[model samples]
Target chain A: MKIAETDPFSFKEMRKALFFLTFALMVLGTWMTFFYAPTEVVMGHVQRIFYFHMGTVWAATVAFTVVFVASIYYLVKETAKWDTLAYCSAEIGMLLLTLTIITGSIWAKPVWGTWWTWDPQLTTTFILWVLYAVYLLLRSGAGGRGKKARYSAIFAIVAFVDLPVVYISARIKRGISPVVFGPGGGGIDPAMMQTLLVVLLGFTLLFILLLRERIRIMNMETALYTRGR
Target chain B: MKAKLKFIVPLVIIAFLISWLVFAGVRDSMVYYITVEELLEDVPDVYGQKVRVSGTVVHGSIKNELDESLQFTMADGKEKIDVEYDGVIPDIFTDGVEAVVEGSISTDNIFVADLLLAKCPTKYESDEARYQRKKG
Candidate 1:
């Protein structure tokens, strides 16, 4: 495992393979969403944005979950690799979450007739975004490497408590956000669901590819800094 | 393994406490966006609590009262409520359209709303679609 982490040959080859896979899947998913999926009877072409919107959200959730787990593992093992994993995942999670919010706002303007609302789902997601953004700032501002890792791990765990709340907010009866999944709800067209699933898979692959590259970049930066010092 | 378990137990307890706190927070802050019928069915004691209710604006029941205030009757096909709001209404708010009003019910059986929101009806033609239709 250490060899795999530090050795350049196999890791670089793996990243290369993931890069191609991510690219291919992304193109195919986008094409499927626009061409294969039927136009929604309600929102028309704007409704097609749901695929990308949901894809990024799910991808962000996956990244955050990794952050949470890696944080916990880092706390237990006190390993730099685990800390690096948590940091990279959090960075990627924040990027995907930003996309999710942007796409959600765009979708809301046409369907909800408003670009923003303080509904439970939206509010919680916004809070999570802020929390993660602060986490990144805290890590960067902390001077020592050990202090940065420890503080960031704690923040990652604390911020993750909102994940379940955000996921279920739309399903709550009082939640004004649209419920895409519930009893008597989430009855999506089969083709639309297929497109969403494909896009989600593509996004997940893209996330993995990005995470690997980020971790590699961070490792190089740390080595360079240490040598400079 | 033993050392890890020692840390894990306390973390698990802390996580449990945090989850409970979240549940309580959500329950306290939740304000259901219910229809007029649901609001009517709710106990009268709930009148003063902050809540959100939704219904179709009764045709011709809207009056722009003094100081940008509105007095309107909204119905859910079964029940209706008189709503008094003091604010700029949403652009999509109109007669027969569904609107969600947030605030509380007053003792006088009027919904005192602080915020108003409306979503465009789903079946309506989008702007792009309308433009395409005109060009065709």
Candidate 2:
């Protein structure tokens, strides 16, 4: 509790401003997804889900990347703060990834005619989910600090190796998943592209907000434990 | 540093091994689907063996049977195969869309598919102008 008062990184005003900014962006993103973006010609209104699907996946990608970076920093600096950052980001990443999978499955049922399939992209994504879920389980069970944090950080770093594979699997290999962006992608309409960008930006801001809040709570817990000692 | 390596070395090796196993396993048997050409190349071997094949639906090759069965020709540019499916067809299924069918090839060379999945278009477009034109 004392650390919460004296913590140099406690930018209360900045966090408040971020909360309003994320809220406004999310409102705008939702509006654009439903009202501003035109109905997809082929998939009809069902394609509206694309905005949310992209948003969750984008945020999840950022979350996992944060975990990977924080884990490396924790290892290098041997700091509890960095480990806490890694753990918090991983937890958020896992939640966002689960949302991504759920939204994708909902969209898939009508578009792909199946709830799930083990396509290359889906397979890698499922593996990524499993790997991170295991990381969370391991971290929770490992307990304490020092050696436990070190092991968990190592696991996080190792788990990150699957992220890129999940990204490129659809492109390099055969899969039912569509390639919508980059290199061989078929691209989207200009208006749809604009809407997607707004949603992506909103999700990114939401992710930062969640990460900051989670890290703040975690730091407080650490401070309380240290004080009790 | 030596103490760190004592733990890090085994961790790295274990990670490498797990990754290798996953990628290798996927490569060997976990491919989402084979191409029409690949399926055709293994004709006799693939016959009656359930497999999934992906290809673009040949334009104007779709036929709807009265029994709710559907028939279409799928092409991978290099090879084309006849596909007969009886299932809930996906909404996006139409001419020029990519589709994956899971079933076994019959002795007469038709793919009898029990599961059919249509890939949504990679390029998303709004035909608002066309819709307006039609309305006008």
lDDT (tens digit, per residue) of candidate 2 on B1-136? 7876676688779878877776676667667788999999998998999999999999999999999999999999999999999889999999999999999999999999999999998888789754775789
DockQ of each: 0.19, 0.61
Please give, as one word, the docking class of candidate 2: medium
Question: Clashes in candidate 1: how many?
Answer: 0
Measured with C-alpha atoms, the lDDT of residue A151 in candidate 1 is 74
lDDT of 2 by residue, A1-229 (tens): 9988877557886787899999999999999999999999989999999999999999999999999889878877888889889999999999999999999999999999999998889989998999999989888884568888888899898888788878877887878899989888978878888999999999999999999899889888878988999
Model 2's chain B TM-score? 0.83
How high is each candidate's interface RMSD, in Å? 5.3, 2.1
**What ranges in model 2 sit over 4 Å off?**
A1-10, A226-229, B1-29, B129-136
Clash pairs, model 1 backbone: none
